[model samples]
Target chain A: TQLLEQSPQFLSIQEGENLTVYCNSSSVFSSLQWYRQEPGEGPVLLVTVVTGGEVKKLKRLTFQFGDARKDSSLHITAAQPGDTGLYLCAGVVLQGGSEKLVFGKGTKLTVNP
Target chain B: DAMVIQNPRYQVTQFGKPVTLSCSQTLNHNVMYWYQQKSSQAPKLLFHYYDKDFNNEADTPDNFQSRRPNTSFCFLDIRSPGLGDAAMYLCATSREKRTGGTDTQYFGPGTRLTVL
Candidate 1:
């Protein structure tokens, strides 16, 4: 089975601190996506990285896909209390013409005020 | 705004009882997915509907069933509620098949199911 290993399952940081989360996998993926989920809510899409070594930025968040397409990272700059949430990484894999998403256990981030 | 919607944000059911979770989408997407999320764990895909086709995950239990009556709506039916079945049920939608690429999924707030 394909699996994604996400480091730092839980993290707590003071507001304005910078932090980074990593997601790694042994199997190569065609694409990877980042999602943020708040309590009592479903996950919201943050970004999708397709090309290897591609980088995308949304506000203070930067997402990067490894050049080998087997890993990814998310960096938050100057995190705020509002940035507290569960961050998940999901990779898309194609098998026999069917595509499925393999997700990491996720990193729960707490940005304290 | 166009979005995915789930009904009965919270549901309570007794063991051995059956429950159904409903999801609707106004995004007019061609694909819909159901996921079960336990505390601090990743969302596990139970199944999905691509247009009228139903695709179930190989490891998904037979007790879990789904139906997509139309493009706008889908349903998840739990034949018997065990304590392990208690979790957040998330519904998501996407425009097309990923194939060898990625398709962004929009998710609903999710329904919290409690099995007593």
Candidate 2:
């Protein structure tokens, strides 16, 4: 089973539309992070949400951490073509007294012009 | 700009051949990590170094090896490349071990490996 599960494996939408991607898990995480990866490149850190029930906004993108720290959501307002990419969510999980970073399969977002 | 850099953006090797991928970071972070990412999948952790202290994942194949001679550079060695080993290899670095998820990891463009 995947430690983190991201919904809508793929998303295609028209420009200026709004959409949200979700990452869910059964285990609690100390921290959760969202990353955006462009084609032929590595993933880039978009935001990190640590505190439960916390909300952060970056430009048109908003990220929220679940109150239980087991889930996270990313919302994009008026998505543009430039926002097309793979959205990955990662979390820090403690196992055997050590912390490990786990990643979800990721949601491939495509915005049409 | 201080950043992570990977060499040989693309690599092609014959089956059973050995290949090496190099990563260097100017950020001088103490933690460097190597990840394997296949198409339409999440990046999988292969191994990492915390200032010469190597940490390998339990499932990482024996064919994979790594070396960190210094803080700025790390190398991933594939002892015997197979078709299944073909994937994008990503190198990343962070200021320290993530405790609160505040330490952001910086990644390189990645090296695409092809095994025939």
Candidate 3:
């Protein structure tokens, strides 16, 4: 089974502070996706990085995929309380016409105002 | 807007009772999935249907079952609910990408199940 290990399982920072979360794996994936889930809600996709060494930014958030396709990272600049939530990284592996995603335990972020 | 929808945002069931959760989609995707997520944990895929084909994960418990009666709907049935079965059940849908690899999965708000 493919496993993803996320670092710093918990994070607490003040508003306007910067922080980064990392997801790493020993196996390669066809694509990697980032999702943010708030309490009482399902996870919402943030972005997907398919290419190696690719970087995509969503306003203050920047997401990067490793060149080897074995890791990914999410960087937030000037974080706000709205960013407080659980961040999950899922690595997608395609099997035949179907696929499965292996998710990390997730990083819980608490942004205090 | 096309999206996934789940019924009964919350459900309460007694131990050993059977409970069913429903999911529907407007996207007409060919694939629908059921996942179980415990508090502060990652979501675990229970099973999924590709068109009419049902696929179950190897480690999934036998008490868990799923049905996709048609293209637009899917159901998750948990037999003999236990305290361990109490968790958020999420339904997701995705269309098979013509370009290959995995297609983007759209998720529903999920149904939080409480076992008493």
TM-score of chain A, cand. 3: 0.98
TM-score of each: 0.97, 0.96, 0.96
Best by TM-score: 1
> Sorted on DockQ, highest at the top, how do the candidates line up?
1, 2, 3
- Cα lDDT tens digits for candidate 3, B81-115: 99999999999888863346557888999999999
Better model by TM-score, 1 or 2?
A: 1
lDDT of 2 by residue, A20-54 (tens): 99999998888999999998898999998999999
Q: Candidate 1 residues B43-87, lDDT tens each? A: 999999889989989999999999999999999999998999999
Which regions of candidate 1 fall more than 4 Å away from where they truly are?
A: none
- Tens-digit lDDT track for model 3 on A1-113? 89999988999999999999999999999999999998888889999999999999999999999999999999999999999999999999876656888889899999999
What CAPRI class is candidate 2? Answer: medium
Instruction: Give the whole-model CA lDDT for all candidates, comma-separated.
Output: 0.93, 0.92, 0.92
lDDT of 1 by residue, A1-113 (tens): 88999989999999999999999999899999999999999999899999999999999999999999999999999999999999999998886666678889999999999
What DockQ class does candidate 3 belong to? medium
Q: For candidate 2, give the lDDT of residue A66.
A: 99
**lDDT score of model 1?**
0.93
Off by over 4 Å in 2: A95-98, B99-101
Query: Model 2's DockQ?
Result: 0.69
